[model samples]
Target: MKKSISKVLLAAVTSAVMLSSCSKTPDESRYIPKTAGVVVDLNAKQLTTKLVTNGITMDKLFEATQSKDTSNEVMKAWKDAENSGIDMQSHFFASFVFQGQPAEHKSYISLTASLKDADKFEAYLKKNIANFSLKTQNDFKYIWEEKQHAVIGWNKSAVIYISAVDPSNLEKYNPGGSSSPDYGDPSEPMIDSATAVTDSAMAIPAALTTAEDDAQIKTWVAEVDHLFHLKKDETAGSIEPFAKLLKEDADAGIFVNPEAIYNSGQFTMIPANVKKLMEGSFYTGTVNFENGKIVFNGHSYMGKELAAIYKKYGKKEIDMDMLNKYPSQNITGFISYAFDFRMIGDIVKATGMDGMVNLMMGKSGLSMDDVLNAFEGQLTYVASDFAITKKESPYFPGEFTEKPDAKWIFSLKVGNKDAFNKIMTSPMLKEVFTREGDHYTVVNPMAAATMPAMSINEKFVTLGSDSALLQEYLGGKGHIKLPDGIEGKIKGSMLGGYVDLEKVTAVIPEDKMDEDEKPVAKKAKELLKDVTFVSKADGGDVQHGEAVLTFKNKDQNSLVQLINLGTEAAKVMQARKAKEKAYEDSLFAAPVDTTVVAPQ
Candidate 1:
């Protein structure tokens, strides 16, 4: 019985986070209070409608994966909310705010749901709260219950959860608690609940009853409310960058202020270079479900120094024509990036990495700049085929090896062939490489032959794990050509790629998994079997890009299928755990040997 309850509890916790499956329409950014330091908003309604139009509903999806004992409190709550005239499809925002200034900062995560039938929702919310009382009478842990503003409990340091109600409209829910104080230390020192003892069931410490502590709770509540209520003297608008992105038709978005993060002093452990890189840039990201695909794009506004470096040496125009050299069909996936490595070297210098590089190269009479000038920067990697090899073979495990081998072909455009050759032919390099007609082939010292090869030309240098792939490309036997449709999508971007999901899934080896896990792996393959991805990145005044994952299935969207896969995996995992638990319990509860042998 205990094991059964544990299994149910595990399933309940897993399903709770996945409960954001309801649908809702878009609402303005006004629902997010200006005080929010970071916010994530989801359009459950739009997603739900999209699923329903394609023949799948949230309820149906859940029912398909239902089991006898798994907890379904979240789904039940969703049904209740929907039936009570609540806008089933409304925008829900999760915001994180720093409660106080640096050194004494207390952070809180709050949620706001856009309300459609406010009166009906409020009545339903109040009734639900009436049946529940505070578990701890004196230990006040502030939790936002339903439409109620925020109930100030005894312990002010507890994590709070808030609902979607206007701050101005919350007067009715405010009990006659002490008015928010004007000024004083608002930090509530974290209480040690594990060790502290109390007479009450909640174990409220005696220190909490002091007048100073009680007043601190009032001050904390006032501070939380103040975050939503903008000050008259303030001029810098609340989350302007993020709000603008929301207004621009983004289904969801997130933002973080560098100044706020730096001042928080919570990130003192991060490296200086990384911190500079983050603090010197502002980022805003958006998600959109359009054109039968889900697209996520992030735009970065680089600080002055970084932008200048990028403009000087990093920027390049991408030419899709280069993709024509690749095999037109039978290709699983490919990635291409247009970059100038020399410019990258310059950026490294600006970032203060030059000193470290110089120290490493000091004895060798080489500098970072000299190293960066050696070869071309642009690169393309193509995965043409995959095969299973055996263990007894000379080149690979003949028929004895169990794992599959991945075959890849890479082409890197050399910036300077002369410099590249000098390094390849250097004394240190001569030990591993032997000159072959126009390039070098890495040789096995004992075998003297079996090795991967690299080719160099005036325009490009190519390497292949399998020499046959390199020979094929050089011989023009199996050049890959991008489909016209995919080509068009990548034309104007500095970097881009396309992956054939069907081709990738077709190669999944079910033999790799245990007999029981094979079925779940097979299900995953089918779920994402027909998806394709097109991605691109562009550099300019602001660097931004998005990868669009398009699904070929007409019956359901990619997200719905993804959720189904997760649900299926969860069910499989739960069953496995239950089986293990039962086995464990049986060992302990097994009938003991009642026959007492002669005492030895």
Candidate 2:
């Protein structure tokens, strides 16, 4: 299975990965062993099961929905969102549409726990999860039943919730859901329907009833909210390890059966292609119970096969109805305020999502958004362990047959939180995910034998401030530097390199002294002329990827010109789509602030 995982990764990165011709050693071959991973079909039944676990039964779910506080808060949040400027009700579109029926998603849960108890839970979670490390621990989340409320924490502000719909239901509304996927399911304990319980120890929830409690739930709700939000006084920086694990579990990475491809005959040529037509893709794990079994279904996918297949049939140009047939991988993923299909999805469909985002980001005609959306369709295979293969050189006959000191098994994905947790425990990932607290860490271990994962967070600093890149290996974070005494800033970032060069421009800083150019700007009577600039190894102007700011400084002003030596420009606005998606996903984290500031 591990070999097969390596093979699939090799296939996924064939074009992007760099290969070597090193000789294989017997010790190295013996080192590679079967990895410890859990893979299950996150089928429809499984998904539905996890959602309504004994802790949250169907009746309890609806009842919670009916609770006065829940209904009131949801209504208030809904109305505030509706009445506010952004209209998720319409002016929004998700990159990935889970259920095509245009369903509205909203979660209302509250939790409170002591710092000591929270730490215990976090430690407990780290102990349970294999490969758990302190460096990556922050990436995990924990959900605990506290007397105050049901606590869920990760990093700083973690909040886990349950949401999703059936694939069949998605096909029912969106014509573009033909490509719907089943990510993976929970194992061992039945994927039973979990009823939500407010007691500690996750006690079984009470029976359903047509009765109402006289105890002021509203007062309690306010206090709980205060504890988590306003009264955050001391709890603000506290770390809840269990909350962390719960949050990590909420991520799409864990739900993927990271071993699917190896199990597929086409990729490994070893494992018999079991007759399973549908394999779950990517999803947030569910902890529901049904018929005494727990299951899962709602999630996202790499959509490699589905997208390849869908595009082969020209599904991109097809309508929503065709989307129903689309692997219909969820598209346009972001926190939506409300459900308004026509204004959000339809309008964007007409104008092109990528193009619109580019325009929103002050650039036009940039297809980066499109490229990213498409990229998601691919990388799916890379998520598995056996997708990458090593020891295939003719120099060694008994390559993989032997082994070495310790086998190198790359993680499909590991955020700094989990990396931190792992760091606290596992020495392997700790050496890698070492960034420190407050801001957090990131560790993208390459699952491929030939390819290394993009080094995650080789630097750490305040969220809004600049941080120096530490590792020479990491691709490094986005950089924007301003020229000395110039009215323009030089900024650029590494893309998978899909940036649209034409749109990459240096914006003239208005704060600088541009008195000379001021006249040129005011008397701009002539048509815009294309001025070619020359590239400088040290201090020359840019021509090819370079350009000179030709403001008429007839007398040659301080040469305070704007130069776009920066990398290409694409829709960098949605670059935080994944992080932001995690923010919206109460499972991983939550909006600590009232509003999330756009990622620079």
Candidate 3:
């Protein structure tokens, strides 16, 4: 029982997070309060939005480090960074390298970022990078683009020189060696006789929030809202369906102010860490939220175009006022709205037998996320049932599940082959399924992904809580299967009857126990004897891991002194041997016999 429950709980969480064959809250009201001031800065290794004076916030700082702004003084000094040669749109990965030594008075730090999309993603990147340059004047050029690059060299402190022009004097003053005119691979060879910084100066980003910062973030939020429009409507083809709620005698007061989210005055820019939380940083749209509506207005550059395409395929505009009324005598208007209206009613309406079927699905007491997720999981199911209409149900999986242990399994499916394949191939869908977080979202077909949609769709999104809506539609066998007093316990989360935990736990028979039966459990107990279940919820397995970095650091000054004293100290002796081996390898035919080993 416990094992089954554990699997059920975990699968439930995964299924809920992923799309399912369920209805989710169509409203965005409840989610807004959660976003307030929650900025997770991923680069800094911090998971928070609280502004600190000393630290930098990537949400605002990346643009500064990514772009060339003369107004900033520290940035102006770092000329190469101004034109780091990497395109911002295409730059998504950051490579970190630690160079040189601290005691030798030569230290360096560099971060490289990239933005490559789809197939051969990295090779496409390598071909686009630039040659590395090291000048005798303590200058370096690491630009990956055509021509222009940067070089750094240091004597007292590090000095970096950047050149768009070959004749620029920045690389003229030699520091380490004779000059090399070659512009070859940056990593191929450190152009012999080329300059080295003999010194170091590290670069860091500027400040985090400024006063002007607040204004810009607000503008960003507003722009996200405008593109995703919301239609204030509930058209369940049968006015008779909402009979109880719409009747003159019944207590059907409209829930006009469904919910007002984002009114908390607690809001902050989306966190830099949001990317790390996602399975992949790449996403389909720019997401934000308004009062009652959570808007995914699409990417600023791609939102309008993508949404227009969806609209073109999914809907045609119609008379908004004629949406919800009982038995409207106008047959022409009704049919027009049915075909011409946005495909929204296709998702959540009470019109016709199908809408009633869906309405029953929504009000079945399953949480909205779970319902929507089932659909996402079985897109094949929905598409198969609704789209192209395949002939049969698997009723059973055909691949791996039937075998005792197998390599494959069939998941749910929707028959919309095109949409089905698109989802299957999407990195975003993989992310939505495997990566955990508040990542999966659904939107109204007609409603724009904006704040206004919040007010309009609030009722639909928050339907899980509206017992009244469910109650109004309940009539036939599909209405609900509640026992005598089950309706009273529905909110209490009783599955079907008046059972409680006390009565449930009483039925645990010793013979039915699996925990003591599985040997793996015995071995797990031994392994977990010292290891902690670091993050257990509901008495479940814990997740934990550790990191380790080990390196050998030797003081070369001791070797230098011994050499000057004409004495072979153990350290100097070792250094000489190491240096000899390095030289031998530098001129080697093959040093496969020499292996790099970790210290014991």
- Each model's number of backbone clashes? 32, 147, 56
Q: What's the CA error at residue 431 for candidate 1, in Å?
A: 5.2
Whole-model lDDT, candidate 3? 0.22
- Give the best candidate by lDDT: 1
Q: What is the C-alpha lDDT of each candidate?
A: 0.52, 0.24, 0.22
Of the two candidates 1 and 3, the one with more favorable lDDT, higher being better, is 1
The residue ranges of model 3 lying beyond 4 angstroms of the native Cα positions read 1-306, 312-600
lDDT of 1 by residue, 278-335 (tens): 4545667877655346677777666666677677775574544445565446666777
TM-scores for all candidates: the values are 0.69, 0.16, 0.16
Candidate 2's residue-wise lDDT over 373-428, tens digit each? 22112111101011122344467776563221211111112223432343333443
* lDDT rank order: 1, 2, 3
Worst 10 residues of 2 by lDDT: 559-568
Please tell me which predicted candidate would have the highest TM-score against the true structure: 1
Weakest 10 consecutive residues, lDDT, candidate 3? Answer: 378-387
**Rank ordering of all candidates by TM-score, starting from the highest:** 1, 3, 2
